[model samples]
Target: MRPRSVRARATLGATAVVATALGAASFALLGILDGNLVRGAQADAERQALATAATAAGGGLEPVLVPGRGIDFLQVVDARGRVLAATPNLSGSPALTPTRPGKPGTVRDTWKRGPVRGGQRHRVVQVTTVTGGGLVTVYAGTSLRQADTADETLKAVLAVVVPLLVLTVALVTWRVTGWALRPVEAIRAEVAEISERDLHRRVPVPRSQDEVARLAVTVNATLDRLEAAGIRQRRFIADASHELRSPITVLRTQLEVARAHPDPALWGELVSGALEDTVRLQDLASDLLLLARLDTSEPPPDTPVDLAGLLREEVRARRGGPVPVEPDLAGEATVRGSTLWLSRLVANLLDNAQRHAERRVVLSLRVDRGRGTAVVEVRDDGPGIPAADRERVFERFTRLDDARSRDEGGTGLGLAIARDIATRLGGTLDALDAPRGARLRATLPLAAD
Candidate 1:
């Protein structure tokens, strides 16, 4: 698009984005603040209701009670919802709300009448308790005037601020876009000449220290990154093609031999072999998809996870096989991460260990509160890894025993995926030296209490 068109589009897009964001944020802020204020009022009223209900249960409540702090009024009602005792201001008045709590816990509601001054609403809380007389309900309430005032004030402020902020953003975006587009013609001409064959070519940097100059610098840096990314992408594609060829070749060769021979006796073995290769291909494809996502996707939102609990579930699921898994899950090891990613991480580690174990896999999860790290250790009694190849095994498709890995349907991306997940989760996976087996341990930052 031309500079004028780009300028217009940039201005409108930025303005729209900012305006929408601010509008939504304003509404959310208003709602959250209003709800919090009302909840605070309700909490205070509920506490007052509980205290008064206890008093009524003890038969110690005064007929004309004094309202608690922030409480507008208090009433002790019987099972029939008849007001037996009330605040002095509400003396001889009937029940404020005919509806009573049907259960044993605190129930809150909003009522506009009964001490709702100046068109304000009131938050009413009811606490039910068993007294000597029978089941009694204590009603307590507070005005929602503060919450209403806060909501109104926020609405007024946002009414003025949102438009002004949006207008400011529009004007600023218009000006900055024009400035950034000043050298777009030269950049366009230069970039148009930079084909895949000559990705190293960069746009001309303007002499002046302006947006165009900075734009030129950024464009040049971007070209550098693109050039590097292109090289890496080509290498990845080549390596992936080479790795994929083995299974395709095996599957194709098996099908061709069976088709040429036409042997009914060998049908089962041929089908089993094809199915095995097909499953390996599937595993490879899934691993590649995961690795690609790990390469480009952002880490998911974090939530507190109990790594010990997660490990326990994984261990339980992987047990009752030829290779039993023993778990020594001890202590609290809570960490913040996507549970899906964490589960995959544990699965990969355990899977790798289980694949390599001769008889059993030992899974250990411990909390290092002194260091604020959660350690998950998986050990297998297999032919131990050499000291020099510990880190090498984490590299993509870096199988030490390629023949064995291929036969066992290993994609060789398990450890790589685990390490990537651990890194994205702000953790580290390492192969540690063991006495008679291979031990791989992952350390993660513990979630805050």
Candidate 2:
């Protein structure tokens, strides 16, 4: 079977419930009206019958009582049970005895006479009267046709009214349901119009604090985040292009110069210069790729790593001369991250410190307080970064003018890559002010069990 639409199903359900309740109420009302009509008609018939009986009683006893057609049946009996008078179409002696003189009685009964085809069914009202020393019993009954007609009329009215009311209810329900869902439809249309280029655009928030308005607020907040991310992505791309273009241009120019001169002595120097540019380009490209991958990849694999062990190995591998070193592995200092990325992150911070420090670089790994985080601090005796340029130093391709000519062999991406890796590993890197030089702190989330 084809699935029903929500509107149809909802409307149908409402209609069914309302129609059933209304139908039941209608049936009950019609029954009550029919009963009341029947009772009123019977009372009217009884009053008319009593009036006819009274008229006959005022006349002579020998005179015959004749009721008009369609009004009632009339009969009179003496004390001996003899039928003294009756209407023309009625026959046979009266079955009931005459009532006592000076006394009155009333009763109801069904009277049937003659063959089935010619017979008539009636509801009779017997009125007894005392007359002449004996008794006379008079019967006057009205037909039930009027009461039946009233009942049928009530039924007809119900047949028309019930359907009309149901139709009205259905139409009203459909319109009201549609009106209630109008806001949702508007929200959907507005959301469809939004795209990446138009992340600044937002869904209209209603003034009301209803659920739809809350949903709009939430969607707008998400769009705000997306817009910020897009801006960052654009800035990153622009910065990457500017960083790559300079080295590439220099390499190309040096190669062109060597080609034009064709001198072996200068050729080697030009090739070396080109090779240096190529290495710089390669480092820049690799860092950019790593940053991109880290931004898109899953959460880093969290494994327990000994911060002190990793630091010892990195310090030993450093080509730069280290004046003095101290290792203080306190509280086990275990953290969670991909060991390879975490090692590179620490190695970068150490390398940066090693390049800048004049005499000594102190490494520390320890956990303080109840929090399960490993802190790796690399403090040096060299000149520290200026407080104003601390944050800028972590940005890609951002090297201080003085450090630009320093023989650090860095592509200026080490700190940027370190920060990216730290962020991905649920950690952070910051340059702290120290007595002699800068103290770089790298904090990573500790491994659980």
Tens digits of per-residue lDDT for model 1 on 1-449?
53348888899889899999998999899989989999999998998999998888888978888988899888888878778899887788888767766666778899876554656788999888988878888889899989988999999999999999999999999898777777887898999899988997889898888877888899999999999988867876777898899889999999999999899999899999999888888888988998898888675558998778888888778768778899998886789997888998888888888788898889998888899999989999999789999999998787888888776767778998999999988889999999977999999999888
lDDT of 1 at 56: 87
**What TM-score goes with each of the models?**
0.50, 0.63
- Per-residue lDDT of 440 in model 1: 94
RMSD of each: 25.8, 9.0
lDDT score at residue 120, model 1, on the 0-100 scale:
73
TM-score of predicted model 2? 0.63
- Which pairs in model 1 have colliding backbones? none
Tens digits of per-residue lDDT for model 2, 1-449: 53276556667888889889988887787688756754554565466556655655676543455565544556676567777776654556454343533457777655554222234444566777765545667766656555456667878887888788888888888887676656667777888998889888988887768887888899889889999999988988887898789888999999889889998989878988898888988877888888888888576777777766777787677645656555555656667776788888977887787777788778888776467777888888888989998899898767775354324577677888899889888889998887788888988877776
Note the clash tally of each candidate. 0, 0
Model 1 worst lDDT window (10 residues): 111-120
